[model samples]
Target: MNKKITIYSENPFYDKSLKTRHMKATIFKMVTLSSLLFSLGFLIFFLSDIVIKGLPAFQQTYIQVDVTYNEKTVKSTRKAVNKEYRRLVSRSWLRTIPQQVIDNPNLMNTKIKLWILADDQVDQYLKGHHHNLKPKYIQSVDNLVKNNATKLRFNIIFFTRGDSKIPEYAGIKSAVIGSILTLIVTMVVAFPIAVMTAIYLEEFAADNLWTQFIEININNLAAIPSILFGLLGLAVFINLFGLPRSSPLVGGLTLAIMTLPIIIISSRAALRSVPDNIRQAGYGLGLTKIQVVKDHVFPLAFPGVMTGSIIGLAQAMGETAPLIIIGMVAFIPDSPNSIMQAATVMPAQIFTWAGMPERAYVEKTAAGIMVLLTILISLNAMAIYLRKKFEVKW
Candidate 1:
């Protein structure tokens, strides 16, 4: 009993164990910091490259040409400009001459000098990119530049028009409209159902086997591949419901299905974050469960619900596989006026442009990617802003 007792803290092994644990934690922190730096570096490089490639697409080459509006020019648009410069101009622009004459009959025999869109080859040459133009066209472009007959103007047509075989006339207008309409449908269908389902599961439903089963299935659904939702849309909306193929209605329905699990899961988490004391106090105040949820719980939880819904919609916006499976990848040359018309979303349009063999479409593809990234970033920013603006401490 008089012998000195050695406590664990006095032992050398104890000190060694503590040292080892600290070393491991330090190593983990260093590794995590390195990974984060690497990810940020890659993102910066990617964004820089896209901006460089896409900047060229916003400015288009235009050549000043003499146009003689006559019967011959109306029939053969090749005669609209000088014979030498005809090869440098866009054929798509030439094709519209007949319609132009019909619209303004007074200009039938007038001669005017105006700037016209150049052919893609000429455009490429003017931009100093790799071009497929022959020596003659290159010389022509050079001469036009020297004579101040050619200049790079802001590419208004690229934003105003739709998909075209000629790169000079192609634009994302139709795709943008299609994306807007599809998202509208998706929000309209998904938001209400997802919010209600989440509220029921979190507040109203009994903790029974059926409820557990439903919860498990919904968790599983959030992990499922998005393309499977497209197949489901094809089977249900297209085959069973007889919905129009490639329409915004079908695309929206498919995306709504895919977005539902995300919103429901997020909403449930938001609802659960409210303290139980709040519900108890509501009950003590002689409020029914429904009144408590609607008046007190829901109001506090609405910000979180909206934030989740926007995030889910942003995810749906960038989805390509699901839309492709449901036939939303069609070549839509005109903006759809109704939800039932054939349409193509921005991602699908970018997909179509990226596959083209032409050199000009490369810039177009990059530009489209930039646009899509901007939109997604904006949506995510809004979500973040909303979450922070209405965050509740309790």
Candidate 2:
């Protein structure tokens, strides 16, 4: 009878195991949220700083002038200065500014400075045997003065012009061209070589002592000082091969050396992510090793490989030390016409401009950093998108 009356109690914190699990889950979520907030805060701060410091690169101020070119006022008939060509041409820019200001009165008070055109092109036009300064072709003279003339100003033109010191006239055309060329050169030389090396090591090479040594060596290459590569480039490309100093080709070569290890390691990792079961299955199906890797392994690895290459490119894009050693930091006035042509990359340009005595250069450097970072982020985004797009499902 006593055993039949068993008492059962329900605890208020019922199911202690559930309570403990809930507490742990709550802690994990809090930690994860806190970490995410901290990371996002840091990123926002960095981006805000870059934008604030670089905003000046967009705004520009110049000195506007009215130029007059009368063919009747031809002073000399010499080959250099005859037919009112030289003066008329010089006067051309000056004439255009006044008309611009007249057409847009808001520009009247805007400071304008005439840009220094190479070859004294205005002089040539003034000296040429032109009948008269065409009324339709009134010369406009707007000289670039201080780059920091307007607050919160954005100058798309300055970003487009190449590196130059032609007073207010210099454009970023050269720097833009050089950046594009540098990227192209990097992709061309680095992409295929990286893919091939990765394939050989992952799919072809035997896992023996020699291969182990090679792997060790490749890893070591990643740790080599970038400056050492620069020194190597200086000696090999400049001193030994007699390549031109400051050429994009030299920059590309140095960057390739710097990037190769990254690409190799990344590609190998990608290839290894392929499950061994997949390979075994391919073999059971009577597929060759090459076919197994080509059809199954390579596809899975491509995403990771592309991501790694993009990361390497991002690093290369921001590299300045190696380029400094190779003389790529020099100011280039015109856009590069060929790979052999000398050029300045955005990072190099930013470095050089940051050291300039003018405050304007500081803003420009900040702007350049922003641009460089933007491109890197874009590349990363592309890699992420590609990863999601091509990721294999099990």
Candidate 3:
């Protein structure tokens, strides 16, 4: 029986418009949630990778033995050994290890190998400490040898030691002095020049063709490749000015030039961010142009300027190509005593170490990288703190 069924469009309150709106809202929320999750995932992955790669450098290997001054053994084994010394010495103590293990026989079957510590550490111990390194009771094992044997205290002495042919012995001495000296040079030179230029352009300079040209140049300079500045430093500072090649002074000057554009741009932006009403108020109060800009404009821009300077320094700190072009020595024969002496920055040191044939050097390079990353992170933290401290919300 084909009965005519009443197919009413408004049988129920089925508002297609409201239904469509609800569907759109659901889609919008899903899209937003998806975007947020994707962003978080990328960030987590990146941070995890960096931490994993960088954390190993801070860990070192060591073996601690309850080293007693076996005077008879010391006298017999170490020719001309000092008797008055009462400090736990290095690998010279190892001579006792073989005999001790031999006499005990229990240790002979144990898995503890004696040659875990590097030979140089052994030499240092025999020489006696310039300072006392005596711990109350050492469990007795060698420190910092090839392959992952045992984890030991992270040695801060890595920072104090001189350059070594052995990668294990190489520490911050290779590039710390050089990198620091370069930063100092950059700060000393860059800050004044950038501040002055910013002031002139923003305050005194006419809004004309020349000013436009200068602005263009500054922007272009900021965009220029860092290696080009290294080339420029090589050509001008090293060649024309007869500055020593690969000297910290040269590296600093090159970095300063590279950093200037950023400083100028940031300073300008900071200056512009200041309220025009403040400038007008200063004018109304009969302040000179210099006084108004210096007292008001500069103070407002200080935080931004600092932020830019720090970022620039961080960039320069990690630059290797430019320093390489300028003949920065990856291996400095001695610790640099002056800016004129040849030097390698931390990045250069890292580059050199990463290219090392030995696997141990890979760890050393990673350690060096960890150190570098610490410095950068600390600098960035300081910048953020400064910005927060001085930020004036409108």
Candidate 4:
């Protein structure tokens, strides 16, 4: 008796396994897409909020007032404008009346209708903010508006001036200048040293205890908190070396150290990406190792190094913790033309303004943030352009 048994290769349940796999993959894709869209939605919402809150700062309300430059007017500006509209005029504007009379002696005892800055309350009312303008002052504002005397005008002072206790006069000029100067010093100090370190470690450093220790320390330094670097600057640069406490020099040097590890790590990665065969080929052609690196390796690695340096600089630009620790919170009304002068960067300035009592500073803070963002975005674009233009794939 011969019995034949047939073994089927297919499982009746295999289609369920395939369907389950596909179901898992589909769920994973949906989850990833949902997360991405959620993050993008939040970012869009945040930017829109900032734009909404900050757009009003670029234009300021102006009011036409009758100015009488007399001895009493010079002595007391409160009595200078019409008593009904005094509450609607900026004190900063009133404070300058005496000076204006002094500057132009011909204007003494003169009454002239002139356009002037509105008070914060008046400005707030015009901008649809919560303001305590009285019923009469509100009527006055409305009358001025009807007469075309109170109107929104493009504010040049906000851009041209520097930090001021008066919100209307406060500007980001000093902060912008300080940021630029700090970045200049940071790039000058960090770039060359970082590149050299990367080159030596990648090509020349041997497998030794000292080299290994150095490598480990560099990595660890990158992980250290930025505030720690600030403390280091406060200790070494300010306390020890006696450098100017709030100068861009101290700030830049601290940022340099902070950015160095980033640059070195990125540069090493860029250098290592070059094929070992390229180095061997150079050696085979009787080129010294130094020449091989200097001639071929460095050119290929520079774009990445620049990209990293720019990114590091952008990070430094937005850093407030370090600058605050190093005494950069001073009220800097005048732009510093020299690096050694006392300075305050944009982040520190924004932080300073955010804590102010005035509502106008809220707009200024957001506007400053927008400016900082613009600069960072520009730097990133430059990095991308350089990377694409100079990067060698082979």
* Top model number, TM-score: 1
Clashing pairs in 3: 63-141, 63-142, 64-139, 64-140, 64-141, 65-140, 90-125, 91-122
**Each model's TM-score, in the order given?**
0.92, 0.69, 0.71, 0.91
Scored by Cα lDDT, where does model 3 land? 0.70
Residue-level lDDT tens digits of model 3 in 13-109:
5554876899999999999999999999997897677566545545444433233324444345432122222122333344555476457755433
lDDT of 2 by residue, 196-267 (tens): 898999888999999999899989989988898999999998999998899899889889988999999988
RMSD of 1: 4.9
Please list the residue runs of candidate 3 whose C-alpha ends up more than 4 Å from where it truly belongs after superposition. Answer: 1-43, 62-116, 119-151
Worst 10 residues of 2 by lDDT: 141-150
Give each model's clash number.
0, 50, 8, 0
- lDDT per residue for candidate 1 within 1-394, as digits (tens), equals 3232356556656664777899999999999999999999999999999999998999999999889999999988898888888899999989999999889999899999889999999998878888898888778778888889988899898899999989989999999999999999999999999999999999999999999999999999999999999999999999999999999999999999889999999999899989999999999999999999999998889999999999999999999998999899898889999999999999999999999989999999899999999999999999999999999898
Q: Pairing residues by index, what is the TM-score of model 1?
A: 0.92
Better of 1 and 3 by lDDT: 1
- Greater TM-score among 2 and 3 belongs to 3
Worst 10 residues of 1 by lDDT: 1-10
Pick by lDDT: which candidate is best?
1
Cα lDDT for residue 116, model 1? 92
Q: Ranking by lDDT, best first?
A: 1, 4, 3, 2
